[model samples]
Target: MLNMNRPNDVEAYIARAEADAVKIPGLENVRPRGIASAGVIGGGTMGRGIATALLCAEIPVTLIERDPATLERAIAEITSIIERNVTTRRMSADEAARAIKHLTTANEIEALEKSDLVIEAAYETMAVKQDIFSRLDRIARKGAILASNTSYLDVLEIASSTSRPQDVLGMHFFSPAHIMKLLEVVRTSATAPDALATAISVGLRIGKKPVVAGNAYGFIGNRMLAIRRHEAEAIILEGVTPDRVDQVVENFGFRMGPFRMGDLAGLDLGWTRDTSTGATVRERLCEAGRRGQKTGKGFFDYDDQRKPVVSPEAMDIIAGLAADKGIARREWSDDSILDRMVLPMIDEAAKILAEGIAARESDIDVVWLHGYNWPRHTGGPMHYARTLGLDTICARLKAMGRTPSDQLRKLLAAPQERQ
Candidate 1:
């Protein structure tokens, strides 16, 4: 059994797991393609970050934005990033100059024609991505890899838009891509071994901790996160204050809790003004312009420094929503709140493993540890669950009116010696 009490043991396990994450079983012998030059489509936050990462890696980059105004803005923002790096001494003045030389801005897809790899960080809609890929099919070089930085859209469906599905994949970078370390290199059913290998190579070249994930809804980290968010929202509706819930999670070692993270990421993400109704807490929040820290309010209010304070207005909104839906309010212990928030995510990880969305349980842990800021000392959700014992987890989940996943049941039924 693993020893959670020893800090050294936990650190060693994480070290080993991170090393193992890059090794895809079947692609062991496949050589990664050289990325000589790259192209990035879109000039939004994600696109600019990706371009910055590429430039910092000393790769020649052509950043394509079809709109003249947006393209101009992207160039300015990327220049500011380079200037900041120099000011912070992260990059020397000479290095910043070279990075500027390496960057090229264009207003057309055809600019990517000679690039070795092209990534589309366009808007996150099926139609928009499909359109981009269809254009890339004719524009990008024959053997050049095509990737989508889509968070949740189907990469396989996106790949189908091209004649070369083998050359297509997903490079799901976290927000603030230039700084975040994790990259989910998603491989579709038709992605070639070398294609996958090449993407992994590029991820490493840009100083990211890359993990191979099978294409699925939300892939690894976000898939499990969806469950945690659902449970977090449910508890608040059941009468736990958002602050109390966030505090419980923070005490459990997360950098920030779900509501706080939502607030930071903006509650209005993917929410539309045209179609929004007060059907859910999030929708109501958006409706009220409590769109998050950007607007200075969400589940919690933010001051000038962006520090959060409990908002009576938000609490009243939550209470009203619960009452409207006829949900009974109840008192909750911190332990209960933690269990409800975390256990469902553990169950979702089981489903991810059983469905081969992740190659190993350790890979899932790596995703959480690097991608989602899962506490390092506890290893990760899976490692923490194992330390808690599968029996205990199943019992808790069952008591909460949830069925244990078949994967968890199998692990439970396995002989103790084998387990």
Candidate 2:
């Protein structure tokens, strides 16, 4: 068994796991096609970041946006990003100029026809993505690899929109795609070997640590993240302060706690302005215009400097919601709070494993480690569970009124060597 307490040993384990993640088994002999030029659909934050990353890699990029104004803004934003790199000394002025020269913008899908690969970083809704893919199928040239940057929607369904399902796949990049290292290369059942290989190769070329995953909702990182977020929200409703919950997680080694993360990401990300019903805490917060840091308020209030402070208004909202739901306020110990926030994620990871959404245990670890900023010392959730002992984890879940997944149970029953 690996020594979890040794920092060097943990680091080495993570390195090996990451190295192993990119080596897809069946595609061992398949060569990756070169991605000389690329196209990115949508010019939003993610699309801009992706276009910037491709430009930095010296890959000619055509960024497509239907709105002329949005297209102009995207071009300006991309130029600003390159200029910022020069200001930060990350890129020389001359190099920045060269990178900017490679970016081209357009207001139609026809601009992507000759591109080697086209990644749709459009809106997250399935209908929007499917419509884009349907048009891409007609516009993109034969053998051009088509991909989606969808975080949760079904890649198979998106692929189904196209006649060339073999050319379709998911290249799920985390926020700030220009900087974050993790990339989930999701392959649908119909995805061609060469197409998958090409994505993995291009991901490495762009300085991303790519892990191949089966097509599934949320893929690996976000699939597991949904569980953690759900539990975090649940505990707050039960009377644990959001900051206290955050403190327990931060103390456990994460960079930030769930509520803080939600605030940073903005609570109104998918909430529509028209549907202003004061139902859930999030809806109530949105109804009040406490969208997030952008508006200087969210679950926590932000000062001019953007640091989070406890918001009495937010607290009242939570309390009122709890009372409305008839949930009694109860103080929870730090350990209980930690368990409530994290154990469910571990359980969901087990389900992901059992369902074969992740190729190996280490792949899941890689997803959490690089994508979610899982503490390096913990060796990701799956490894952390093993370090805690499968039997111990199962017992803890049982005590907390949760059932361990069948996969976890099986791992517990197996020989130590297998675990």
- The candidate scoring highest on lDDT is 1
Instruction: Give the per-residue lDDT digits (tens) of candidate 2, residues 364-414.
Output: 888988888888789888778878887788888987789888878785566
Q: What TM-score, over all chains together, does every model reach?
A: 0.95, 0.95
Query: What is candidate 1's CA lDDT for residue 34?
Result: 82
- Worst 10-residue stretch by lDDT in candidate 2? 410-419
lDDT of 2 at 174: 88
lDDT by residue (229-318, candidate 1, tens digit) is 889888899989999999999999999999999999999878998999788899999999999999999999999999999999999999
Lowest summed lDDT window (length 10), candidate 1: 410-419
The segments of candidate 2 whose C-alpha lies over 4 angstroms from its true place after superposition are: 87-89, 273-279, 412-419
In candidate 1, position 136 carries an lDDT of 90
